[model samples]
Target chain A: MTALLEVSGIEKSFGGIRALNGCSLTVERGMIHGLIGPNGSGKTTLFNVLTGYENPDAGEVRLDGVVITGIGPGKVFRLGIGRTFQLTRVFIRLSVLDNMLIAAQHQHKWLRSALRSPGQGGERAKAMELLDFVGIARLAELEAGALSYGQRKLLELAYLLMADPDVLLLDEPAGGVNPTLINQLADKIKELNSAGKTILVVEHNMEFVMGICGRITVMHQGRALLTDVPAAVRSDPRVLDAYLGGAEDEGLEAEAVRTEGGSK
Target chain B: MAILSAKAKPISKGKAAVVVAAIAVIAVFPLVFTNPAVTEIAIFALMFMATSEAWNGFAGWSGYFSLGHAVFFGVGAYTFAIIANDYKLPAGSGLFLLMPVAGVVAMVAAVLVGAVALRTKRHTFVVITIGVFFIFQLLGYNLSITAGASGLQVPTPYNWNAATFNNPFYYAAAILLGFTVGLYWIIRRSAFGLQLLAIRDDEERAKGLGVPVWRVKLSAFVISSFPVGMAGALFAFLIGQIYPNTVFNPLFDLSWALMTLVGGIGTIAGPLLGGVVLESVQQYLNLYLSNADIYLIVYGVVFLAVMFWMPRGVVPTVGDALRRRRGAGEATIAATNNGGTDSSSEGKATGSLAGVVQEGGK
Candidate 1:
């Protein structure tokens, strides 16, 4: 199998502190990959670098052996990498369907987008179908802000799928989701992987990540600690040491804020 | 017969009648109120309506509040004046003819302005817009083509009847307002509009979704310039002269934003209605009080009162209450932002959504 997404020696620093120091990762075609690290370990920053939200201070990211760095998030998305934020950044004031339509905005030429409703005839049905797949079809008419946090995560997943991306970078898919919904999300990820879409998911929910991902990469202090099957990674002493008393919500938010501040 | 049809989303009969009636009233206003003072007030209101609607079409929807849109207005006025001066048109022969050139020139100005200003967002974008506006204002003052602060005089229609002189200007303003309103309505429902809505709500998410936020924003800013520049040209024609200070006035910027904010910031009808009512109120207070200080103070007080009561602006605040009254329970940020688009239609969507849920249970 070939590596669909490969990053080598990515170096990023926010001020004096290094966020990504020579981080390297590779996801083979059609693989379900898990990226896990403790708070401030640079998992999210690496995601940012990979998705073109931040330019790496050094190193390379390649999709199908083509270098993609410093291209910006919009170009990154068009290059077939769709991502969901850790904080679930759906358009709060748009209707649920409208949010999905914004993702399905593939016919992105100026005049076409202006003349047709964002729900271009085919897109409406497709958006509704994806919403149904995500189990939020019933709430599709409501504003996305009115949705519960877990529902918004599901909506984020559903909408990103509208682009039919070759790769998806989900930042903590099971973070605050209820158990039943977590199972549903897990099943959906597996289904997506089975359907030929490669995925790299970041999660603090160890069981969900270990159960779904075929290969797991552990990060520590802006560097890759190790990469192996979930069982071997879980049993590794180095991996356990890197985790640093488990990933907590406050730490995640603090990292989110720090990286956000750094980006600005 | 209607119950059997599949149409559940279009505007209702009552709304249609109300819209038709409003249009009829607007169409007849100048004819019925031939008095110059009343028509003058109407003409100014229509100008504000046009400019505010165009402003809202960009800033209100995209969440980039530009306090320097008067640059486009000034550019349009100057374009019209310059063309008229060089082309040597007879007095009143083709005054409105130059207005389209004004619009095109304004659009070109928007392209240059938006290319730079749209790169930033939030407070920085606002500041950049102000900076761009001042640059244009300074040009209006210093440039030889603009004739400095002395300004340029353009001729009004020579044969306008004394009793009905304001009528022609009034119609010009009204037609421009109509055109702007139509564009706003179409854009509000377009996919491009939704993308703007997304950008306003979350720029990062919009980008991640491949919405082309930068280009979309620039386009909206340019589209907004056409009507605004035309309104500027019309204002120049009405006054029969244009000055740098008057055409590039920051007051124009403040008023367009204030009217949109007071009417309903992001909704289609917000700026249109807000401009008319707010201008009328300002005009009424000035007419009665006749003192600049007192009337200006009174206008401020009235504006504060409007905000205090309708915090989200007239259309959204009222639309939210009406939706709640009808049991849609759509009392969210969107109740104020999306205007009244998704209210009743949601019921029908919910009905079908429920059926799908039941089917899923199987």
Candidate 2:
């Protein structure tokens, strides 16, 4: 059978530097997949390409053997691949629950979908259930902008779940989060994985990535270095080199600049 | 689950009472004050309110910030005139009956025009709209079907010289205004409306969250164009004549945008309140002043004052002040959310998408 998601030879460039080059991976059904890399190593870029936020220069991405390349974010999302950003994006002006409502209606025919209230009965229950799943159910009534940083991440995850995407792409879910929240997030990921969802997470935090993901993919300089079980990935010398040997990778500032230029 | 969705903001009992009373006062306005001159101001007020509200629906909520909505207004007016001439419709209600056709024609034009214009990014989008506006304006001057600069004189209705001359126009404008406001109110509460508000906040994020951004923006633009086109038709009938300059005036676009901005864009009452007050002051200024240029200066001042003093617009500012007076917490959801929305939306008035970064993939 075809893998749940398959990517082969994806390439993307910005100005002079390659952000993603010949990136390839396969995510089996229901696997908690980890994508970890050093700074400027194409983890976010890969996610962006996979989700159609960035159209790859040369590549094929198939979901269940159906080629889904450069379909655009809206179509990609409607096709059941949900993604969350690193910095925790949510509609600050909208109430938290309405955030979920927006998610469920994105693919609906605008004429009919817009006129009918998506806030009624089943959808609202599902929204609350997702919010509860992410532990932000209590904050549903408040505006998303009013959420604390950690709470906003939870809300972001909650809204993504509102769409019930088959594959979840979470970028740095543990970044800037406190330890308590990190543990909570990891638990949620495991619970979600066991309940029949496939997840691909890009994280800087090794413990967070290793603790939950069933398999891990290590990327270096815009290419996947290896994909192995966490124990095998943990002891890989190349993974250590990708993290440490590159002097520029040590500073957060250079990674940030590359991220803004490459990811967007 | 019942978290305050946009649909959740019910009109309070007191607010509802005030709304009913206001509508009552307006319903009898032409009768209570029979003078055509007074009724004329109310008529123009209604027309502007309707137009500004139309502008607000797409430009205000979707963050598209079109400066060329006058294209729809003019298209509607010209559609009415062209259809009337083709069908040889008479001067009375027969001519008036064609207004909805005018609206449909404008809606079609908006779909075509907005489809092309909406493809560009925010700043480029503004420029394209302005460019289209000029093209239509030039077409008004050159097109033979439009009778060139000679202008088309509409047939005068039976009530042209009667005491009730402005009454039909007045009531029609009022109905148009009411219809526009009600439609927006429904739209603002609908799921579509929520998506629009999301687009306005951060378009990239909204798209990332799965919103079909371009389709939503285009839908709103077309929807907004219908009322604006109808309003133009009504205005065309009221004038009993049509010219490219008269129907497609840049000032109409400018004034409507200003009215919506000063009234508090993105809120239903804001456009209505701003449209009526600003248009009344404008008409009143025109009545007393010998020159029209002076009122333009007044508009300039009002624009600056609105920018500096009540940048968030009258309704929002007043609402906040009231909430503060009621001893609401400093960090209440409204205040916290508005703080982010206030800045982005104000920039949106000039068609800046400073907050949107995620759309390069296309």
The complex in candidate 2 yields a DockQ of: 0.40
Best by DockQ: 2
lDDT of every model, 2 decimals: 0.80, 0.80
A1-264, model 1: which lDDT tens digit per residue? 899999999999999999888999899999999998877889999999999999998999999898989998877888889998888787767778778888878656767777886665567778778988988887777767667778888999998888888999999888767778889999999999999999999987777888999999988889988989998997888776665445433443454444434321
TM-score of 1: 0.90
Off by over 4 Å in 2: A246-264, B1-9, B158-161, B326-362
lDDT (Cα, 0-100) at B310 in candidate 2 = 77
lDDT of 1 at B86: 83
* Candidate 1 residue-wise lDDT, B14-109, digit = tens: 556866897888889988888888888888898998899899888988888899899999999999888887887776736887787899999999
Worst 10 residues of 2 chain B by lDDT: B353-362
Question: For model 2, which pairs clash?
Answer: none
